[model samples]
Target: MELTDLATIRAVLKRHGFRFSKSLGQNFLTDPSVCPRMALACGADESKGVLEIGPGFGVLTKELSERAGRVVAVELDESLLPVLGETLDSCRNVEVVPGDVLKLDLAGLLKEKFGGMETAVCANLPYYITSPVLMRFLEERLPVASLTLMVQKEAARRLCAPPGSRDCGAVSVAVSYYARPKILFEVPRTSFYPQPNVDSAVIRLDVLPEPSVRVKNEKAFFALVRAAFGKRRKTVLNSISSGLGLEKSEILTALERAAVAPSARAEQLSIGQFAELSNRLEELKNEQ
Candidate 1:
């Protein structure tokens, strides 16, 4: 069956008595070209294991199964389970697991399903849960080598944005600390069965061996990052002092010690600079 075909998808949904749920962000891909391109971009191969999220109708699941040795697709919508079963029947390598990716024990899941093979994630992610899903992938520090995701266009820009770019956010900095993100291509809103309001872009994040910078405390480093960007309009000095509940003088001193300009905004500093600032702040906190 041509899973990406609009008529076929509608027929499958009708046969299964399926209805699209806006809350679930159930937009099935209708573009045959997009899934193949996403699979190729993911660099999936016979030696790798692929974990796909939100495998609506198994279009992308089938594509990944063709390239990877094993594919485990996590679908939160229970109604789609049988539909996936039917669509992915011939793809002996693909397994559709019904559960929320956010709540799953990813490390355990990876160990069990992808033990002997290198792992990667390839999915046309639900826009509503994009940040949480990506955060789980990054914060867990999973063994996955890379993630190739189709996300909202604006989100793609923010994820791949450089430190000083206007598109950069706290999440952008956090993502950069974990991986090298780049936007590979754009998919029009019309590419889906129920077209989304916004266009989407395919982004690939190659996981780094270690964090981009050295910090005394990982918690303190991310806390500082969150504090820095908490008030977008404020200078780094102001934001840190207010967000972290530190005296402005103390924040200024830490910035000075780190050789970062106190006048710089959070977005103006690179991950390394933030690390330095965070380490200096930690030293001051210890002295007090």
Candidate 2:
């Protein structure tokens, strides 16, 4: 159906009486080449199952269905259901699920839709909900093998950024801990039907079998990471002490024991360093 064709898209929307929802970040991809490239980047093959979020107009869904054994697309906007039905009519392997991915039972959905298959996520994510969606993807620890997502260029940078880089944030740390993120390519704003203000990038995150760093407590590890990045300008020791309600002296002692400099900023510490610091602090707390 050539879903990425602007004229075809316009005609379908007009026929379905579908109006874009600004609040929902409804920028549909109109560039024909982008979707195929994104699908290729996902490494989807006849053996793999794919879960797509926000399949606006089903352009990416169509591309994915061509390569993957099964494609389950979850769309939040019900108005697009008819449009997707029309666009994806010939794609027998595609399933259009209507629901908020954030609220859905992802584990159950994966088990039901993609059982006994190597699964992956490929989506042109809504920019506003990118962080939370990525967090949910990682935190839920879904059985998906990888995620190749279209996100804001800046966000892609942050997600794939190294721990000691300026672009690194709490999310960056979390992403690094859980997956190996890399920016595949950038998409110009003109790539969309209604051009967005900022450019987008395709990022591929290969989920690790286990986290990159080992710590005694995952909750405590994440809590320490959040506190480290809570106040960017503050020293890691001060930030952890204040954010975690630990004594500054105790934090300093833990830092020393972990071989981390007290003056080091969160941005300057590696994931291993954070794990070390977190473990030392946990030990000190247990001792007291």
What TM-score, to 2 decimals, does candidate 1 have?
A: 0.98
TM-scores, all candidates, are 0.98, 0.98
lDDT assessment of candidate 1? 0.93
* Worst-scoring 10-residue span by lDDT in model 2: 1-10
lDDT of 2 at 280: 93
- The global C-alpha lDDT for each of the candidates, from Candidate 1 onward, is 0.93, 0.94
Stretches of candidate 2 exceeding 4 Å from the true structure: none
Candidate 2 positional error at 178, Å: 0.7
**What's the lDDT for residue 280 in model 1?**
96
